[model samples]
Structure formats: structure tokens, C-alpha cells
Target: MNIHVSYPSRLYSDKLSLDCGSTRICHDISVAIPDRGFTVIIGPNGCGKSTLLRGLSRLVRPSAGKVHLDGKVISDYSTREVAQRLGLLPQSAQAPEGIRVGELVSRGRFPYRRAFSTWSDEDERAVLAALQATSTLELIDREVDTLSGGQRQRVWIALALAQETPVLLLDEPTTFLDIAHQIELLNLLRNLKETGNRTLVAVLHDLNHACRYADHLIAMRDGRILFEGSPAEIITPSNIEALFGLRCVVISDPVSGTPLVVPR
Candidate 1:
């Protein structure tokens, strides 16, 4: 399915609602992910942030309303069609047993290949670039099971990057990473947005990191968005308290000048 991907990819929801089993987590909510920017969703656990991402990426179908991609209904497209336009790095993804890093990463090219097609030069370049982008080129031949926790996370991210989709959704992408690697991954995400103009969305727990790197911030609570705006506009003591029930003082981060939340 050859889908024309326009620049600054458009991905948004309209009156979107979802049900996980019998309970309704996400209500009638409408959110527009910023085109070609780093948008971060911050909330406490079980706040439906992951559900929202799943719905947006079409992993979980919305029980009502719609999720639109490039101005068309997301469900209207085939799975491969959607995979070619959007990619997702889900939380706690497990690689197949004995799968090598290169083999795992190369699987991302499935959306672009024909049935029984041989690997092309384009596939090799994409896999190399993905490994390079995640700084895992040296581990390309290593078995995924042999890698450390952080290394496995990076390899998973490489798999997502190798998909080469215009819009990418990540759920807790910094999990299992050290502070240094977390910062590195965040920087890489921002760089991906700026350099490729890719629309990047991530669900993060660190409010300070979200404020530091996100062009747009969404505060979710009880499966609903309480606030959405630029970090400076949306991240305040009042919003923090409302979102997490934790009273905190907001200060400026000296390094990035973004909002810094300090608990009182």
C-alpha cells in the first residue's frame, strides 16, 4: 500500500473514547498532537496515558468517536498502510528468543517489502541508520537476549526508528534506562523532531524532563486531559497539584530554562 506521507504529519483525535474490557477509561476527549514537534504526556500511573497512545496508534480500537491520521480515519487504512505511516515503541516490548539485534531491527522494513521479497539496499541503509541513531551499531550482531536492560531498550527503539514512519508514538520510552541514557534518548527524540520534522509523541513520568524537552505538554488524570499547552503555559504549581495531588513549587531549570517542579 503506497501511502503518500505529507510533511508535518497530521495525527489527532476527534471526540475519542475507549473502553478496556468493561470499564471506560477514556471519555469523550479530543486532542490534537502537534505536527512535527515533541509532545509529551505526563501523568501518574493508570491514568490511561498508555491507552490513549494505543488508541492513537490503532493498537486498541476506540469504542466510540475516531482517531484520524493525515486527515483520514485511521481505521480506514489497512494495518500495513498504517504501519508505513506511523510507528510505535510500546512499553516492555520483548524480542523473540535468540533474535539478533540486526534481525529484530530489520523486521521493521516489513511494511515496505513485498511478499517473499529479498532484502534491498534500502533495507540495509535503514537498518544501519536506525542502529546508528540509537547508538547501537556496535551491537548489531549481538543476540538481543544477551544485552543489558538499557541496551535492549535502545535496540527496541532502533526497531521503531527503522520503521521510518512520519509519526511515532512511544509509551514510557525511557524505561529501564539510566539518567544519562534517558537524557541522551530525550535529546535524540528532540533531534529527530527537528531534523526530520517528524511528529513524536511520548508518555513520560518525569515532569521536569517533559517540560525540558517537550514543545507541547499534556497533563492527564483519571483518563482525561486536565491541561494542554506549551510547557511554560501548562506546567504550573496549580496544574501539578491538580494532576498528581502533590503540592509542589515551580521553578525555572537553570540549564534549559524550562519549568522545574520542586516538592515543598
Candidate 2:
């Protein structure tokens, strides 16, 4: 898979600082999300990967510095404008009780419709495509609350896909998924990246999966990015030990030829 790439994209940050309530999470972090590549943020617990994702997506305003999209400050844009350009799947996403899957997914079209605007064929197509992309089309009419954890996760991803933004930010999307579903989701993300028109950024805890699927890997520790590069260039045993305090052996994955980490 030709994963490593940096073409062009609007999503980038300059010395972005973030706060979780009164506590500061990250400081002076800068990242340029590739125009058509997969960027994964990896770190130990409490290292602020999720907070960085939120900052990039504008779910939370940067405490300092700026997040820029297409050379403009992201915060300066209207909420609708932001939604049109960026889609976000937060880790704690929840659905309203009794909300059907179709209804929830349709909410992604909110930015495209006005108060009196009717649901157009374009909207329907996007929703259906998103559902199919996530393999959730069969459950389109099901209640969101009734699905299993992995199914619900897929549905949430479908909602983000329905947004149809060129830039998508996800926070631990594999959470609540079993091993098989996790691989399935990562493969789906890889398929999305094949379009060469979308920027996919995610925070993932699975080091080996990150290596396999990420075009660019960012390692964070104590609220700072320790190092970043292609997985093969950065996923060394020394880097693994520094990032997670684990002694590990790094080798090539038999399937993808990407780096694979095994703790000693």
C-alpha cells in the first residue's frame, strides 16, 4: 500500500495549545495534516492525543496558538462553514434515545440545508454512501441504541462520512471494537485514503495497527509530540521504549512490511 504521502490540504496547526477544563494538555504543538494521507497520533494514557484531535477539529478552541484551514483561522469560520470543511468523530459521541440510525446519520447534512430547505437527492445519496462505506447500510433503519458496540462505532463513522468533508478527525475510533472489527475499520479507512482527496487523522493506542495503517505516525508523551515520521522511520525499539516505557523489539510486519512492535 502506497501510504506515505503529503499532497495538499487545508488542515494544519501552529503552536496549538489545548486545555481540558482548567488543566493544560498540550503545548506549542504544530502539525500539518496531509491533503490525502492517514495521520495517526499514538501515545500512552493521559498523553493528550484526544485533546490534540479535538483542537484540530475545533471541538475545543485552542487555549493558545491557532488551527488553520486553507490559510484562515479555523475559529474565524462560522460553525456551518467549519462543518462543511471538517468532520469529527469524538470518542464520547452519543445518540439521542430512540433515534434511528438513518436520522442520526442524516444530521451530517445539517450544514448543507437551510431552515426550509427540503431533503434533496444529493443528501440522500451521501447518507447512503456513508452507510455503505461503513458497512452499516443493512442497519440504516435500526435504533442506534440497540446496536452492539462495534456496530454503533461503525454507525458513528457513517455519520462522519455522511458529512462528506475533505478533512476527518477521529478520536480512538477503534474503541469498543473487537480485534476483527478494529482491523476491518482500519482497512475501511485505508480505502477512504485511496481517493487522494481526503485527509484522515486519528488518535490510536494500538502501536502495531498505527504502524500498519498510518502514512505518518506521531508519538506523544507527557502532552508533547516526541517524534514523528513514517512508521518505518520512527517506530524503533528506542522510540517505543521512550513513548511507552516498554522494552520492545521492532520488526517488519509480514503482511504489509510496516513496522511491528513486540514488547519484551
- Work out the TM-score per prediction: 0.94, 0.94
lDDT for model 1: 0.89
Which clashing pairs does model 1 show? Answer: none
Provide the lowest-lDDT 10-residue window in model 2.
1-10
> Model 1 over residues 1-264: C-alpha lDDT tens digits?
111223333888877888899899887768888888899988999999999999999988898989889879999999999999999999857789999999999998989999989999999999999999889999999999999877888888889989999999999989768998899888888888888768999999898999999998878888888888899998888889899999999999999999999999
**What 10-residue stretch in candidate 1 is worst by lDDT?**
1-10
Segments of candidate 1 deviating more than 4 angstroms: 1-9
Q: How much lDDT does each candidate structure score?
A: 0.89, 0.89
Residue 84, model 1: Cα distance from true site in angstroms: 0.4
